[model samples]
Target: METQDGAELCFPQLFNTSCKKPSSSTTQAIILYTVMSCVSLLIVALNLLVIISVSHFRRLHTPTNILLLSLAVSDCLVGILIWPGEVFMTTNCWFLGNLTCVIFMFVSIIIISSSVGNMVLISIDRYVAICDPLHYPTRITVSRVKLCVCMCWLCSIPYNSLILKENLTHPGRYNSCHGECVIVINPISGVVDLVLTFIFPITVIIVLYMRVFVVAVSQARAMRSHITGVTLQLSATQTTKKSELKAARTLGVLVVVFLISFCPYYIFSVAGDNSYTSSAGFFVFHMLFLNSCVNPVIYALFYPWFRKAVKLIVTAQILQRGSFEANIL
Candidate 1:
């Protein structure tokens, strides 16, 4: 108690109850804030570019890019809404009060759950396109994909509300002191969240991608082998096969990167509450958020249309007539 008494309180007026200000040095805080600020800004800007390119360009519109568009919007929201609030909570104290806290948690959960759902949808789309090419066209149309996206978000509302019901109903109920706003869940709830958000979705992604990888390798081998047939028909089949493989590879890279970033955060969750809120946990959460920034980079690397669109959008050429119909693909 005597040692703790020397520590500065976040809310000095709170007397014995306020949390002590974190013992990080001024230099460390500055550095941390700088890095986080840069990351937050990059996420917002990159995802904004994705949003504009997808929304503005008609030729780029496809079922798969539609899912990417949905994910980018959620990522943009993470930058705009989650980052500022997180910056405040981590650096300073929770001065925003209970209501804001409740809303923040609610929105965060919804967006995150919806993101996981979107990933699952993306994996399924890829799976069908690759493993079951014949049915993919009729099965995974624009209307159906859009419906799935909407349902994913709509379902998140009730699902997360139930998960966070206590926090919503009784804001600040889990805080240990005046300045803290941590959300605490029991082991049961933690397991439930893990199974729903991380366990099941990740399992589906990995399994589907693994299968896709094997089939892709075989298809690549087949592409190399000679096929004796009529010239025009053989060329068309080769073109179609090449297109499917490219789509699979691009989305495969995206999924791999996502899993690498996301696994740590949830792995820590399974480690218990202490680990979930620890400094290490905070770092993993940052890694999870890092996925948002990495996504547009992936698009830039793999998608030619994204690069062309970025070029046009940057020069404000997207505003010109017939720009939407430009041969971006």
Candidate 2:
């Protein structure tokens, strides 16, 4: 009986100090592993297409595409690092040590915070493009957007490090036993994280998008009423307006989907949820992970340029000389 019980412990030699193995049946664990593996691969592959599409095609190198590229980079990291880490936590012990666990925690927080920052920046971009088109060309240049993306990432590292400072200084402080990896955010830090990372960014995104939507609808109505007769210059202006409106609609969908995926995790965390072992916590986490996969799908479904670029990429046409000069838009 002692031998059999020892087999259930994550570190048999540790005896009383070791964590017990997870209790799920082998079949269920296998199914979960398979599903998560496929999702991780899909996330990486799709985001890679987005990254290449925006980077290789000069025509797609607009300010908005630059923001999308930054987002895809963050999402790809989610698949490359976070997914594998979560899977390992699910199926095995954290034998990698407390330092590794804290590092993973820090990196994951950086990714999450950067994603929120990107969403806020995208919202601001759309707002300027739609609500202040005259100044947008001067205001939202590619160079400016790239700088903002860099600042977003650079700021994330320090911000999250501050939030996880306790865990960083005392790795594995929250672990109940050997073979466990955990981090606890005290109530004070949790409130700060909730406000800055969740509430503040979300509020800004919602407000900017709301203003963009209102302006877009008004512009669309104006264009319809003025459709009868116009000079060539006025017609071209109308065409630009139409394209801006279409982009607003597409990005509106993106923001809504992001909120749907992200809100549950924050909500559950606020409700005092502690462990991903619980069904509710499990669902919340996977919902958040699914967002990274769903974003590239949104791009494919809404952006004609994305579809055209993907076709070129998959057909090996992108390898041809002068492909960067190809007209993707």
User: Each model's C-alpha lDDT?
Assistant: 0.84, 0.89
Q: Could you tell me every candidate's TM-score relative to the true structure?
A: 0.94, 0.96
Which 10 successive residues of model 1 have the least lDDT summed? Answer: 273-282
Q: What is candidate 2's lDDT per residue for 1-329, written digit by digit as tens?
A: 13354457778788878888777789998898898889899999999999999999999999999999999999999999988787777577889999898898788779989999999999999999999999999999999999999999999998888888899999988889888877778778888999999999999999999899889989999999999888899999999999988888988898899999889978986887533445576577678878999999999999999999999999999999999999878
Which one wins on TM-score?
2
Candidate 2 deviant stretches above 4 angstroms: 1-7, 274-279
Per-residue lDDT over 173-281 for candidate 1, one digit per residue giving the tens place of the 0 to 100 score: 8787887767766677778989989998999999998898888888877877846544787778777888989989999888888889888877777777522245785
